[model samples]
Target: MTTVALVNTASIQERRDAGGMYHHRTNFDKYHPGYFGKVGMRHCHLKRNQSFCPTANLDKLWTLVSEQTRVNAAKDKTGAAPIIDVVLSGYYKVLGKGKLPEQPVTVKAKFFSRRAEEKIKGVGGAWVLVA
Candidate 1:
């Protein structure tokens, strides 16, 4: 018979700063406090705020498409409606919140929630994943 012993060594401690900001520290690393320190790759939107997590809601997308369409229509002399492309390369995730657009729009993003995919398809729109 073989016997194995397991030991738990992981620990987390809450810390408060002079500026009144609360932080957490793990036993492994004393310097960096939270998961924000572990994110190495930088996205376009992340450049603005290190702690910013982007979530693109459907309503926002709809508004963007409408605004673009309006601008394109204004430029057209023959009153032709041009297809609108909503490029969301800056966003990390697209959430299915609020109403979808009446017109079909092509959305390009990194990740999409299940509900978001359904909403886009339901509105005769298409979505593509970008690297």
Candidate 2:
């Protein structure tokens, strides 16, 4: 009780405070914290597009073709093939992963790979750029 009696003149509760808990920590940078850099006019907002672009592949499209079309090759029911439309938003590019789609499907995306574009068009499908 003698230690508290010394500094308890102003306020008895104030003596318990051990302030500056984060003083001079090694990892804590005051000026330059995490994700640092002057972005644009306000140094807070970004001037250019900083979002990452998502991608799509042709092998994935084949799964849909197999689902909506007559996939039973043994039955030989390949009459009046249905052209399926695949709408992919937030995807910048469509890649052909060394595999071609068996059926025609209209792909709506921003960009298409050389192989993917060729393969889609080669099968009488369409690639509509949604820019």
Candidate 3:
């Protein structure tokens, strides 16, 4: 029995040139032409549309409300007690880290922590989540 083996006869130079040609056309580019898409543009738009609000703590809210409003509970010695409205319009979130106010206050904010809600309710204060 006789056996024969076939081998590729292409020269090394020709193989190298072919390899170079194969890699000449590539999908990747050093400087991509259309790199930034609609998503990237949308990111820019979101950055522009972003709104920032100041944060406040429980104690800060008490002081802020006291400063902004003119209603005094002390003034009413015989009549109905005044209702202190703490409209934290520009505040984004109210934290429950500080001391709770002795007097019940109506807090209107965008967001509040769980502890803040509990403290507010515990002190007979009302919390309103505003848009």
Candidate 4:
């Protein structure tokens, strides 16, 4: 079994600037505090903002997953909506706040996001931590 995670490029950068969180900020202007001597995070989204992440080529990572999983949602309906396994950098205060499903889903690959974990767990799905 395999899984897929989708993260917008801008979200990664947003997480780095918010002192490890992604909220209460607009842009990455000025040296963000608490980033001293530590390697700064990188942006995977093509655009510099989250609003444009959808247009970014997140396919780079998805393509690899498709090859390994043998489950291409693009071709098959059963495997189409691959459980949104991976977590993006930012959180959806409203969306993530919704109730989770109620079922056990054997996690195959890795995922990020505390909220996502909680959502998955609420639905009785397993949340396998990864780096």
lDDT of each: 0.63, 0.61, 0.63, 0.42
lDDT of 4 by residue, 19-80 (tens): 43334332323446553456869767667554522211222223323453533434554423
| RMSD in order of candidates | 17.7, 6.9, 15.3, 25.1
Across residues 12-94, which tens digit of lDDT does each residue of candidate 3 receive?
Answer: 55665553224632432344444434543333335642566567888776566454342464354454433433443456888
**Any idea what lDDT model 3 has?**
0.63
lDDT of 2 by residue, 62-81 (tens): 55446425464324444444
* Global fold similarity of model 2 (TM-score): 0.51
lDDT, candidate 3, at 118: 90
Give candidate 3's root-mean-square deviation (CA, Å).
15.3
As for TM-score, the candidate ahead, 3 or 4, is 3
- Candidate 3 clashing pairs? none
* Model 1 Cα lDDT, one tens digit per residue, 5-60: 67443422222232223333343245545634456675654455555657778777
lDDT of 2: 0.61
